[model samples]
Target: MRLRKGLRVCLFCLAAVTVLIMAVACSPSSEGDTTTAAPPTVKQPILEQDPPSGETGELETESGTESGNTEEETANGNDELETPAGNRNGSAGQLYALTFEDMMKMDEALNHEMNYIAVDLSEMTQLTEDDKTYIIEYLQGFGAEIRDRTLDQLVEEENPDQSSPSLKGVLLRVDKVEINEDSAQIEGSKYRSGTGAIGVKITLKLQKGAWKLSDSEMTWIS
Candidate 1:
């Protein structure tokens, strides 16, 4: 009976040790619940912001105004270069029918000789031999009838009072321009103190990029 009691005591001690080890392995830990870390969160970078309402409106208005100004400038530039359909005169691109303003300028150049050289020569021929010689030389420089006028006739034919049908004028005003291929007909009038008025036809030819006085005819004089 003493042996059996000792054996029971030994068996009871082994079972208690085994049970304690199992409880220690299976229980939840304080460190796992309170001190464990969580995963890190990602961050994004900031770039730009939208403009204020007033500033945005102002910018849009300025852009529109600039566009309008550019268009107006383009139109004005084109106006100068515009030509008639088919470029009827055959001289197209930047060279069109002469404007009235240009016609007036041409008339001025033509009449300059009539008022000064012609009248001056007519008066000079009567004064002296030297004056007559000078008048002849001067008239030679002119193109047509004035160049052919004899010295004696110059002295006798001078009619500054406009009683005779002669060209003596202070102004030449061009009123019409008729253009043909490489040529143009210009009609205008001459005005003088005593001569009253005269209608004249001038023909011009384009040669080497310039309008040259090809012919001139008097229609009527008063």
Candidate 2:
């Protein structure tokens, strides 16, 4: 009985050691089974850049749009400028006609006021041959012919009170003038002592940078 009791006690001790070893192996302490829960997942935040705002950004956008519009407008304007309605040649023709008309008017005024006015004949030296001849013919109609008259002769003829008063009163009065490239026509009335009114037409030719009377004729309507 004593030997059996001792054997039983040794068996009990061995069983306890085996149970402790099993518990330790199953508790995740074994090298092959030891795994720590993956370190608490740390989420990283994503960074994003935002667009610019406010008046400065708006101004930039507006400036770009305005620049584009200006370029387009400038292109359109250039197209219009490329063509002109009345070109240089047309304008020059009109100017020539206008110049001739002005010269005719000046000539008519000078002739109408011949007696009461003193014209500086030196100023006439620059006149075209056509203009000189027109003056001479006009003076001749007033009974004071100026054939081959120098500048001095014309001055003496036009001096106030030198010629007869009756003759001066019969001088031609210009009514209208019509000019063309080659010719100009002057219409006027001659006043005489008892003859009432006589219509006169003087035709002038453009020659040598001047206008000269080419023809002088008288016509009676009444």
Tens-digit lDDT track of model 1 for 41-83 = 7787988999999999999999999999999999999987763
Pairs in steric clash, model 2: 128-209, 128-210, 129-210, 130-210, 130-211, 130-212, 131-211, 131-212, 134-213
Error in Å for residue 94 of model 1: 14
Score residue 210 of candidate 2 by CA lDDT.
50
The C-alpha stretches of model 1 lying farther than 4 A from their native spots are 1-44, 80-87, 90-112, 115-163, 169-222
Count of backbone collisions within predicted model 1: 0
Cα RMSD (Å) between model 1 and the true structure?
15.6
Ten-residue stretch with the least lDDT total in model 2: 88-97
TM-score of each: 0.28, 0.26
CA lDDT of 73 in candidate 2? 100
What is candidate 2's lDDT per residue for 1-222, written digit by digit as tens?
Answer: 999999999999999999998887787544545475456789999899565678678989999999999999999998877632223222222222323233333334334433432122343343445444444444343443334433244435555344422233233345566878877776655432223446667677766655555776666532
RMSD of each: 15.6, 17.4
